[model samples]
Target: MNKGLFVMALEVSNLNKRNVYLMYLIIFLQGFVFYGPVAVIYRQRRGLAVSSIFIIESISWILMIILEIPWGYFADRFGYKKTLVISNILFFISKIVFYKAHSFNMFLLERILMAFSLSGISGCDIALLYSSINEKESEKVFGRYSALSNAGLFLASIISSILVKYSLDSTALLTSVFYGIASILTFFLTEVEVKNKNRINIKLCIDFVKSSKNIILLIFAVSLINEVVQAVAVFLYQIKLINCGFNIVYFGLLTAFLQLVRISSAKTHVLSSKFGQNKSLMIFFIIITLSCLAFLTLKNIPIIIIALALMCSSSAMISPIILDIENKSISIQDRATVLSIYAMCGDILSSAVNVVIGKVSDISIEASFTFCIIICFFALILLCLNFKGQFFNKYS
Candidate 1:
């Protein structure tokens, strides 16, 4: 890296750092708010059938898909900080609505707004971060960003669990408070001038699509497969524990432990740098496969706990590696848009899989895990082929 570039990378304006941190805080609040009432909502709401839940989630994802490209263009033209502030405001309002929501219809409305708000925030935050850091130092900065974000997630989950354990009704209110705080913090963030201030043309989008075809496909496929597998495993594991008379708190703790391990492992970049991106991803996929198999075979709580840890660690490993690969392939100008498209692919697949997993769980829990393993097997094969291609030539 050039000396000047190195200095520039480290010299992010105070405003940008503040903005990124605020986005991180909002993401933390988002997870906290969403997960806090999930199990309780399903358990207590008489009208909230599986189909209703799926519909709400599907609507959210559909909204995300519709908004992703336009919002990415908006951020590019208007500025990332402006987009962040707007998103935070929307999210704060959504949280309030969610707290006061009385019926499934109201919940769905709140969720759709929440999804749009979150989608706006997603790509813009990363684009701001990439703009602030030098291209050469982006990987290191992104790694740190991911680690800190995961730590925030772990803390939020712990806090949300405590809130839910004490009073389900209060959880939404508490989450809304956090969202408000995050929204307020956004006011302090500085705006980054987007490189291409002109309106995004179809030509740019098309060129980006053309340039990113292979890597985009890889990211999409891996993300879709991974989410499906993880969702199935989580659904089955939760049901199994509940049926076997395990405590809910224990499950929360198990989830917290998994996140903690993921946070810890994300800080270690040795494997990523040494083995190369594809190899590291391959290892993670293999670990996930083995973990899923272990979960299928093991009946012991302690052993299953270990399997969960492995599962999360493997899952955590995939995102950064894929992001790193994608980053290398696209220009900074279109990076966020490309990544959002990548995420949208996963969201679409996961939404569909959530419905299928819900039905499968009702029939046989083991069948879900078996299905996930099959998906993982397909993922592994695709990944292996990806590793053998020209894509690996540049990275490895």
Candidate 2:
């Protein structure tokens, strides 16, 4: 549904409508990073080796892994609005730190701040959004919510095509200003009513995951696909672009095209509704699998664009449906915490896959893609293994 039509049909409070639109604006602003289109090259030009950048990222990932559950617990126990308000401020601070950073230690500080900021907001944002809307609208709302970030990136990439020509530092500075504005907006968000639950903590989240067989299976299967997507689309695409003789100056335009592909996220609800969640997920997973196969065997421009479209479109389509399915398993009282647990498990899988893919990529890009193909196949196998009648159908 269109945004205006959705609003007209909402049957929700004015405050709820405000929360939805406000969050859309906030998420879109968060994606307005001028440096994003050229993150690795920008870092390299700022006096750090690619290896050092990876090390910083590894540390940042580890830190977020450590913090995700605790932050979720905080959101569940206190309030989502409070968590968002705090985390968005931290997010802006991290962007400012990035703007000024040139040395490795300085960059590490930025990463550390980002770890705090990102982990704190991990599942809280979605939980808040899910709370504010009617359940039937979840898919449409989440789809558009997912797309707004890419819409921002689409705009940023256009700006970056201009900005990277001048100063990379300017990209970070401009990005910080948008983030600072977003941070302030969080202060005005209405908090969803959180149920008072006892002993909300990391241990509780751990226990919940351990016992929820369906959720455990779902998270593992989906996370594997997400990791491969991040590796192939985000990390490897840049390298492939360079290997194919694309110059650095055109990186923004190229990445912008990918973001344009991701904008298909807004239509995810249609796919999931037509195919059913499990079948929809399987179809998209196969799409990614074929795209990886292309990476392993083909390198022409048309093939490159086709493979990218396949991967990005599949990824965009999958996220909101996955979020919607996962939320179905969560109780209202533990929504934030359980969602964080889902994120943590996904991160654990991602961190491991990233380390292996990084090492493999150092040997051969083809070899790295081969590894991604295996992950995709494994994910497909997991998807097949799911007993929809037992797991998904119950929720449906």
Candidate 3:
């Protein structure tokens, strides 16, 4: 009995390492069901106009923005495991709604549900992984997580493409099944112990902002750039491709190709090591801006694909790096709440921009791309401000 107990303790001590791999698996499942390849096309097939689709997506962003900080506070008070489980379950239910819905109102309902699910998961997942892993191994674990997630998307793009070829309803059904499995997987996750489970409110957020105002601003700026590009890519890029004279069959393949680019770019820390973090971040931001410019001007499929590859690569490269920065910038106890605040600011921007993009797209997809180019420049300006000395060094 003593020997068995000793061995059990030994295993529990090493659980963080195991959790890293488990997180990778969980993130991969999420990517698989993200349904990126067929999302926009599926809405169009369901008879939703592009403008209406954006309105629905905007509503999702609005809900997410509203709930993000509160959900994070709840996770901090209650526990990460329960919040994550609820997120998966809510997502599964949303997928079911999506599968059965033939009307825009039904899809709107699904988006609302999905927004709540996303709000719960956004900060909690990263906070859980950070709390579980050794601080030294964070960058490596995050890189692996991002890579595996993209690989899952790579597979999902193909699977969703094939399933969508059969029917949009079929794609939704399969996505729900994936989420169901993911929900079951959450039950197996080891919970991170929290010492302070007291209820925290908006003051916690205000304190964080006061301490790390610059970093928070920088994080929000980058997040806005990332979410806008992501929203457009997932929901409207297919339309851009269609305008470029590509067939629907190639959408999945193209999306799969972007995932590969993202996977390859996931190791931005390596770039940071080679060329200091500031310089490396600047380079990637410049790449993103240039890619947007290319998309603005280029009409050929090959050129557009190249531009998309650059955009995805930069977005993937910067995500974990920025999270690593934010993780270091704030207190561990307040991590999830602060991070949610960061994301909520971006979603607020996303909600507003989604409507504009949708409306502009009604006139011309090219004009929409032009709008994206302008947004990228705004992000670049913010990035430049942060790179100045002591700019993000307020609390750090």
lDDT of each: 0.68, 0.85, 0.79
Question: CA lDDT of 96 in candidate 3?
Answer: 90
Give all TM-scores, in the order shown.
0.85, 0.92, 0.93
Candidate 1 C-alpha error for residue 5, in Å = 14
Give the per-residue lDDT of model 1 (tens digit) for 237-302. Answer: 666566567677554555566567777555546678898776777788888888778767777877
> Per-residue error at 285 for model 3, in Å?
1.7
Please provide, for model 3 over 1-396, each residue's C-alpha lDDT reduced to its tens digit, 9 standing for 90 to 100. Answer: 999999987787678656667777888887785356877777777888888988888889889988998898888888888889999899889889988877899999999999999999998988889988878767767777788889888888877777766776776787788778888888888887754678666686767766765675577568657855775567656777787789987787888888888896567678767887677778877887787777777788898788788878877878777778778777646678887887887788778877888888888877887887777777777777777635435556
In model 2, which runs have C-alpha deviations exceeding 4 angstroms? 1-12, 197-205, 388-396
Error of 1 at 308 (Å): 1.4
- Ten-residue stretch with the least lDDT total in model 1: 34-43
Return the top candidate by lDDT. 2
- Clashes (N, CA, C under 3 Å) per candidate: 0, 0, 0
Give all candidate RMSDs, comma-separated: 3.8, 4.5, 2.6
